[model samples]
Target: MIPTPAFVVDEPLLTLFAGRFEAALERHWPNSILSYSFKTNALPWLISHLRNRGVWAEVVSDHEYELALALGYPPERIVYNGPVKGRERLRAALAAGSMVNLDAKREVEWAAELGREQPDAGLAVGLRVNWDLEARVPGESATGAAGSRFGFNVENGELDAAIARLRTGGVRLAGLHMHRNSRSQSVDVYRASASLAAELIVERGLELDWVDIGGGFFGSLDDSPTFDDYVGAIRECLVGAVDPARTRLIVEPGGSLTAVPIEFHASVVDVKWVGDNRIVVTDTSRTDLDPLFRRRRPFAVDLTTASSATVPTQIVSGFTCMEDDRLLTLEDERELRVGDRLVFRNVGAYTMSYQSTFIELPPAVYVRDAAGAYTRVRERASVSDYLRGNSWLSPES
Candidate 1:
């Protein structure tokens, strides 16, 4: 039997979501790229699964870029993004015809240098556009007045200069990337971004090969916007200005594609009372599931209770020693006895990507097939497992 405190990927659910996303894109924009955001959940098994299904990789770091390559993604199939792309890797990606969206000044410089070096290589690159999404969407942006720190700022004339510099250095500006995290993930948020991309393309007369409306779309939640809702909004804004026949529409979905298909299972091990408060301690820690510990919203949970009796209040806590390592509070619910299991839903996005080895090592991960058969994809990390890469120093006797 698989142990408690394990992550289970519902394979049927994952296939359903993946098929829906791909079908939505095909219906709205036939020439579209549905790239899986690597930073969302870079588990090797997850990556291999998506890769087998023919989804391209969208990575944000040099390591992620390399990981994608090691996982059998052709450089051309990978979308290399983020500001921390190393110089050597950046040059290699450009030479290999990867979709390298230049986010850092050094990247622009490197692209320019590569342009000068390989004038005949047809070095086409994209520029990530940083516009004032807050002003347009009004409280939709996560960055608010501070604005997003990524990409080249549109308001500061930096984008204009970057464009000119790249062109002067012989690099063809082939696409525009407008990806912003939103608080609302509403149709209007995507509408505004697509509108801005269309505007920039028209105003600059940029004949681009692609227009990437970056991901943050809500996926597989109650009353959440679906893939169709997001793709339709983008197409509505860009159809007149950008040709679907010529320019490909790219979307990098991380949470939207990964969040709902996996679950975290933790079994109740102990129950205690302290000063009128009843605490339910589980075998799993918040670090294993909610690494950020910033989720204020209640998770959709299912309880396998050992009793039919009810409780007024029960503070669901994790195995960590930290006083505040609480997952959530159960109120006016069934009393959870020892051996009861709690399953947390819609936690597949950043949880696994950010899961750490703190007081305990990583837990085993299982993928449950459509027939309810469980197969272990990753074994639980032991002490020796965790120490695999570290150097051990022998003490001098």
Candidate 2:
């Protein structure tokens, strides 16, 4: 029996991605550190693989920090980063000796307090600066660009003040962090960011151990830029700006690691003809499989069935009450049938991370080995899983 709706990860593709990343780092910044951003895909299996490859864990939350620790990543190897770090989380990171990237002025003070409490602990801290650049993706802005909520606006006094405060407070400034753009597929954009980083360091006269170019590198996909091109562009931009002997480069890659390795599969449960449209209902919903549907992002869908012929255009709908829960609307009048499977590719990054168990639990996750073998990685959640922590009972109950 086939699973109604499932997520499948291709292990071979992931291995290729890991190798490409390591090779890129070695070629560009030989002494640099590559950290995997946990917010992208925090699966333990993926995290363990990154750890095994000597990749550090870049965490944005306490849960991610704990998850990294659970994956056997040493505290020193993890960089704690985020806009909101609760007191307890901050203390834990400091006590664990993880490098904390201070997002705000208050974070600097908090780190100072932690340092004072544990004088011998000696915490290393960095600052996140705003770059004020726009990204290639629609509706996704750059972190370093103006009006971004993340990072300190260097145009303003924020960056200068933060640096001065740390310098006078005797705090160890370890690095500079910037996540300028989400879709950093274009080499020009990445080079611009690198130039900006170099300019900021030189203008501020700040001594830094590392310069963190936060991950936005596009992964390998037919529609996306190649990994080599993206890495080469970054290398070109930083070639003369950063001293290879003095400063170590750091990158936190997220999407580039898992995008091409995962694919979503859903089985058609029902088929109907309405007016001039053919609607195919699937077991998966926008909430369960592709949350990008909610944002009106078009995903490429391919039909996987026994028939080798192409069919008419059809509209794909989910088994949900919401009218917005649509996977795709085939404009070519493609025909679809029950029991047929639809495959959504390049959805490895934000789809599962943003998936919700609303109306139904998320689908199971399967792993495909190099030999074309499939195994269940995550089991399908039952209705009980959703009601576990809920106190509200239905009237029928």
C-alpha displacement of 109 in model 2, angstroms?
Answer: 1.0
TM-score of each: 0.97, 0.89
**Cα lDDT computed for each candidate against the true fold:** 0.90, 0.77
Candidate 1 local lDDT, residue 62: 88
What lDDT does model 2 reach?
Answer: 0.77
Q: Model 1, stretches more than 4 Å misplaced? A: 392-397
lDDT of 1 by residue, 1-397 (tens): 4688899999888888888889999999999999999999998999999999999999998899989999999999999889999999999988887888889888899999988998988889999999998899899879889999999989899999999999888999999999999997998999999999999999989999999988888887456688998898899999988899999999999998789999988899999887766799999888987799888888788998868888888999999999989988888889888889999888899988887888998888999999999988988889877666566543431
Candidate 2, residues 1-397, lDDT tens digits: the string is 3476888888889888878888877886788778888888776677887798788999998788889988899998998888878778887777777877888767877777766666666566888987566642333464333457877878778887877776555577778886665543576667777778778877766667787878888787455566566667767776666676678777888988887898888889998888877888998887865565644467777787675544466789999999877788876544677898898887788777776867777788888899999988788878877677665676444
